[model samples]
Target: MPGGRLTHRDRRDIGAGLAEGLGYAEIARRIGRPTSTISREVARNGGPGGYRADHAHLATRRRARRREAIPHRDPATPPDAYGRDPDAVRDFAEQLAALMVRTGVPRMAARVLARLITDDSGSLTAADLVQRLRVSPASVSLAVRYLEGLEVIRRVREPGHRRRRYVIDDDVWLRAWMTSAQQHAMWAETAQRGVDVLDPATPAGARLAHMSQFFATLSDDMSGGSGTVEDALTVLAALRHAGTSLPVAQVATALGWPPDRVTEALSRAGPDRLTPAQLGALQGRA
Candidate 1:
């Protein structure tokens, strides 16, 4: 089995196999390589139907030359690498961005998020993003704003600096999830209101009522307010009411929840350390 990089001859064979209508696994087996290796090579180049061995080989050589030509100018830090493969991180970033796009994330925002997460510095100015992504500054600014609106990224001011940089942290996903649940609740409320205005016995009113129920159910599921989640929240509320940190055993005892349930509830509720008022706000009561 060939464990090293695919040779030009291998690519030609792959192209031939594709022309012969062979699946990726068949081609890989014939070439003595893993299916995934063959799959990535094919997908990265031009995909199954469009793949051309000569064109792929040339493109590969061009990318190799570009990497070699770019000098590593950061003396204080070594080149980014994953197990000595400097390009692995870049490849992963693009792959992640592509996956995000496929899963309904806006393309520009996905690209920007991927770049930010892969950056060694963990933050980037709009100008820095423009340069790195080779996109217009306006495009970067718009993508950044979209991410900020979703609560998936933050803008932080650098010390003694006038400009801000964008960053992502663990809290980002939590906030985004909460924001989505909040929106669901808002939709539920709007739909419920529509039912009343449209006459509850009519077809339109029935549709609106069903819509309201659907969103309400989704909101409850997302916010950990139903099923086992309801019990967990009750435990959380009790703990918060104590006004001081309590032991896991004590919390479990007070709420009649299992220790494991208490632990999970606290993990979801804490970290951000939501006060009673904040919790109320999440539920749209405040």
Candidate 2:
């Protein structure tokens, strides 16, 4: 429907919709804008409870002016090899950084990650980051350290270069996901300990127990072995097709997998973790 930056009237409408407790989708529908537009607008200004039309309009104008003042590229920088527009690329990076900020990443760290990931090499030295982000070297160093702590980026030195580079690997997200799962598991363990220390029958203990269970389940789901869900599902399907319990060796042979690999897959789809139907299918085997 409508396109371009939101007008002051649109911000007023968004404020009215928030006041009425309308959802983002409903507000966007009423204004002929995308739901994401409404969501980001509200999120950028304040949350639903604090959003003010005038404040939001002013903030948007300030952001626009700041963006306008930023240089898109350096004169010494080469053109994109694929001929993509530098301005568009810069805008997309900013959008990505904003989205990451909304998802709980610190603003500087998010900007660093966005810039690194958007680059063709997925790597940048502190100097490169400082120059490109127009931030101090100390700022880039802090951001990279934060990102590294999350396991989403790592430091490496080029073969002949003395300078260190912060590199985002292709599997950066996978590493970050696993890091999160590990954190959840740690929380689950701590919560369980709290439950024991407080006596499980007490109200506080019960709350801790629920918290422990929630995080434990989340950790299990997110921390599955190196195999993907598709691989696990395939193993389950093979068991289902067998119509009777098959030993690991037999299933491995049937699936053309090595014995150890099949064993790993079967362990991942353990009976205690399977659905009723899946459990029934593999009843005789562990």
Evaluate model 1: give its lDDT: 0.80
lDDT per residue (tens digit) for residues 18-128 in model 2: 899999999999999998788777755546766799998997787668668875546455558898877567666867777777678887898899899899999999999
- Identify the candidate with maximal TM-score: 2
Report the alpha-carbon TM-score of model 1 versus the true structure.
0.59
Q: Write the per-residue lDDT of candidate 1 for residues 1-286, one digit (tens) a residue.
A: 4678889999999999999999999999999999878877875565665678999899788767765776755534445454434455656666667677667777679888998888777788988887676567888989998998887899999899999999988576787888999999999999999999998899999999999999998998888764445665787678679988799999888877678878877666663777887778878952
> What lDDT does model 2 reach?
0.83
Q: Candidate 1 regions off by >4 Å?
A: 1-84, 230-286
Give me the displacement of residue 140 in model 2, in angstroms: 1.3
lDDT of 2 at 236: 85
Provide the overall lDDT of each model, using Cα atoms, as 2-decimal numbers: 0.80, 0.83
